[model samples]
Target: MILPYPFPLDIQSILNNKNIFRRPPTRFGKMHHTITHPFHTPDQLPMTNQRINHEPVFLLASAPWRESSLWVEVFSRRYGRVALLARSARKRQSELRGVLVPFVPVSASWYGSQELKTLHRAEWIGGWPQPQGRALFSGLYINELMLKLTTREDPIPELYDALEAVMRAVCGENSHTAALRRFEWTLLNRLGFAPDLFHDGNDEAIRAEETYWLTPENAVVPIEEAERFNPRNHGVAVGGNILIQLREGDFTHPESLGQSLKITRLLIDNLLPEGIKSRQVLQQLQQFSFGV
Candidate 1:
């Protein structure tokens, strides 16, 4: 079957479904088509006046706004990813200033009807420890990935849980690489574009002794078949055993973590837009320090 260019990956649709055991759907044998911008709730309510009820949320990202108000983006357990205007948060005297930092859990309340919601109250959860150095950067990378991949007001409770787990791992001083790999694998699977690591395009199960190549549109295949259908330059070659382990999310296996790092990098690079600064910074850091 001929594959379409610029695949949707149908991340949202997949996550919304309660059933995760079924084979996720695939798009193929079609002409190329461009996807339009997803429908956003810009017109649903004026961000400046609507009121959002208070609830516990994970602070994903925050930036300064005006003189005192800070523009914050949070992944709320109840409201999903949202934009909030935290009044006077940038002020040195504001209690909310330090409480809303990224990776911190906060109980936030807001009200607004405009495109930008206004923050009414924020209280820190206070128990979780701060992430340091590389873990901090890794947390930012996770936030960036969510911002780029998720839609506002769209809830992925499972993804939220995974994010919290990653934060916990980071806070407890676990290997950031393992944390990232697991979280990323879950994120991709949570979104519909999860790779079919255990099977070929023709529905045959892969053997552990074989070598394989993966393509964004075609899933996985034997290296020989991939070279015949598409040039070797177009795909990333990986070991079959790694593919099987990834299929099972066996991140504890030494090979799984290593392969996860490699495969996730390729997937993110292929999925994201060009000139993403985070990716550039990550590449430079890798060159200077090899592995994280």
Candidate 2:
């Protein structure tokens, strides 16, 4: 349930500022919605090329803003993690209301300062199924990872593809543990933080019998040296079999998957700077719930 690290942006602060958003009145006093808007349009306000031509994005997590809007955090393919204020999507007849739901694909439109942006519109790309229970938890895990690693306005197209892939894997009948692991690993790599799994920086082959640890600098060293460099105690001396599997992007191997889980969780935990609410909920549920 514990976070690997602290987040740069104050998610708690943003959550506390939910008074600024407006949630629409519903029969049950709650309404669910998802919305997507494109990155550019002729109608958009004049702005620099940097802000005007952002790539299409996905809004992965959102909370009720106030009475009629949403405070959303999105994973943009070209813009990395973006915080936006989606206004008035909760009206009874609003198309955006139904389109703003999480785990669904949507292209978002936004403009603002280099920090937070204003969400102008959204359009759904209806091809994926909604996640439930454990799948929902897994989706949240992906969202959390994106928020933790990506910076605002930074592009990460590869992570976006990996994310879409995970969403597909989660919606299917199969358990998405392996898919999630690969996405996590890919995120770390795209962020320029993941350690090399196979060869050394000099391109020397890794010894199959030796155990090695991953450091932030992408260095693979003997287990003894790991303790000296691993400030967070999250590094592991993984088996070479797992390394080979990772090199091949093979998630089907049970041993490889297990190692991927261990190593990725460590790296993410160590690298994340802020608290993750969903991750904590997931851990508690996993520990206590058997029916799940």
Candidate 3:
């Protein structure tokens, strides 16, 4: 199978789905070709706009609907991710045209007793700067992840919190690397796939002075105690101090950010086997920035 060019590492683990270490879904090739925009409504009505007056939401995506409206995807605290059909949202005078944008928090008012909600009104609840440049790419990547992993109207309270934190971090344009990595780890942990960041292969607490290797099996092994695993599987090497910083979401140390990328890249590749559109866009931006 031809691999996606987003990363050049040995991504055989993604194809085989055997590593089980820091694993993500291995069907992104499927996510790419088939489920380009996977939109769905809640299976049950109780999960819809039952008691919530105006739910805080982030517009994950939007597609043309009926030539004058939009089929929007939104991520909310109790509603997980859901689809809303906004009538006349594309009209020149529509309030939603300016309100339903990704990265901006909105208070959405929608009503329906069925699976899909008909969005009536959306008000800006913004108090943060919008993500721009590289931050925009990061936001797109994150929105794609949410579109892929989250179910309609399912409560993702923790992931919702992480999303808020990421938006603020990226717009802040400081420590974005660590912020992105932390979001990736949080997603994996919520899915019960990520390993413990504070402990190692022997279940011992990671120390600041030690050097460790992150194995493909998601094991954090002390440099001196890494012989049990296959040498080839002993992946990126990182300092225990950096791991500690990563654990605490501290990006003060530049090395910690680089190390975080190496680790998260491996884990994400493990998750999506086919390819990610946002990754391609990001690579293009990087190449353009360097005039390559």
True-structure RMSD, every candidate: 10.0, 11.1, 8.3
* lDDT string, candidate 1, 1-292, tens digits: 1111111223233224443122223343232222122223235444445566667787655555556565666788767778777877766687776678666577888876765677888887765677766676676677767765665666678888888888877776757678778888887776665666656776788888888888766768788787565454456788888888786767788877877788887776666644344556666777889665
Residues 151-198 of candidate 2: C-alpha lDDT, one tens digit per residue: 555666788888888888887746888888888878766665566666
Q: Which stretch of 10 consecutive residues in model 3 shows the poorest summed lDDT?
A: 1-10
Best-fitting candidate, scored by TM-score:
1
**Candidate 1 CA-lDDT value:** 0.66
Compared with the true structure, all predictions reach lDDT values of 0.66, 0.63, 0.69
Local accuracy of candidate 3 as per-residue lDDT tens digits, 121-169: 7888865877767777788888877776665666769989999988888
User: Stretches of candidate 3 above 4 Å error?
Assistant: 1-37, 40-51, 113-115, 223-234, 288-290
List the lowest-lDDT window of 10 residues for candidate 1: 1-10
Question: What residue pairs clash in candidate 3, if any at all?
Answer: 24-271, 25-271, 29-274
TM-scores, each model vs. reference: 0.76, 0.74, 0.75
What is the lDDT for 217 in model 3? 44
Ranking according to lDDT, highest score first? 3, 1, 2
